[model samples]
Target: MVEVAMSNCANARPTRCIGVRVLGVSKSIKGNPVLDTVSADFALGRVSGIRGHNGSGKTMLLRAIAGLISVDKGSIEVFGEEVGVDGSFPMGVGFMIEPLELWDEFTGLEMLTLLSSLRGKFCVDHLRSTLIRVGLDPNDTRKIKSFSLGMRQRLNLAQALMGNPRLLLLDEPTNALDEDGQETICRILRDERDRGTTIIVVSHDREQLDRIADVQYVMSDGRIREV
Candidate 1:
């Protein structure tokens, strides 16, 4: 169980070290500002949580960092290399956005295989291990199509662990998980941190954030401020 103080504390640390730096980042969609000159430095190997009400631009920031979306202004850097707006950064990131989608026809393992093929990197052993780590049974692949909502969440988490991504961006990772699934996620995230992966989580769950996050940012009206 996570210590009660962890939820209230604003600072915590995981064993791994991964670094992020942002400067003057801003974004506008169709003339409406979504992010305005946001800047912050994130310690590598630690979990940083982003909390905000709906429409606060948390998703945009994660997409920008993952090179999935463009920023109209400002810059993002990982480890010392600038992540240009153009998707030139190497595929060292794993991300999960809102409205998670999965094929009802494909088994969980099949989905993993498909994603690995798309990324041009396949590690079957690693993939199976990740699935197991996230509380999924490889043998259960055949039943993935029939999995419950919580099972689907575990499948998604397993996919993100592929390639041992250097950075991970997750949005409401525990939204559909049960207590056990949530605990599994926390353990996997902690293990990833031990391996030096930088994790950025966007969620409104204060209790979950307190358990895993080393720092927290609150977003409102498309602007972000550290808390």
Candidate 2:
């Protein structure tokens, strides 16, 4: 366990060794501001947790960082490369947003194979390993359509972590998991950190975040601050 002092600490690391940087980022959706001049440095090989109320711009920030959406102003950098510099999708990132979706017709392994194929990378061994890591059976042939809510969430996370992603952006990763499953996710995240991956996780579960996060931040009304 990371054992972070969640209620009152947000560790600020030096910029030189950072993994991701959000600089003066602002976004307005149909004239309503979503992100306003937000800036922060996410350290390399560390887990940072973000907590906020609904519609607080937490998801938007992750989208921008993932290059799924562009910010109207400012920029995001991953490992020193600008996120939208070439108008191309950001590379080396894995993320799970709200309202997780999965292919109900395919088995767990099949779904992972398809998702990885879309990225032009697939390894059956790796995919199977990922499924097992998330407490799922690689040998099970049950299509995802028949899986429980918790199972789907685990598969969702497995995809995000299957590859060698330099950065990970996860939203409510433990949303539908049980107590043991939640603990499993936390341990996996810490293991990822130890493997030198930078993680930015957004969750409302303060206790959960406290266990895995090295530092924490709080967001409100399109603004973010260390806590």
Question: Using TM-score as the measure, which candidate wins?
Answer: 2
lDDT of 1 by residue, 74-133 (tens): 998876677873567635888787655788888788889888898866778877887888
**Residues 1-227, candidate 2, lDDT per residue (tens digit)?**
22242212345435656789999999999999999999988877889999999999999999999998889999898988899877877788988976657778899998889888897577899999999999999999998889999999999899899786889999999998999899889889989987788899999888888999989999999999988
Query: Ten residues in a row with the worst lDDT in model 2?
Result: 1-10
Q: Would you estimate the TM-scores of all the predictions?
A: 0.87, 0.92
Residue 180 C-alpha lDDT in model 2: 89
| Pairs in clash, predicted candidate 2 | none
Superposed model 1: Cα runs more than 4 Å off: 1-18, 141-144
- lDDT at residue 172 of model 1 (Cα atoms): 94
Give lDDT per model, in order: 0.81, 0.87
TM-score of model number 1: 0.87
Residue range with the least summed lDDT across 10 consecutive positions in model 1: 1-10
Q: C-alpha displacement of 140 in model 2, angstroms? A: 0.8
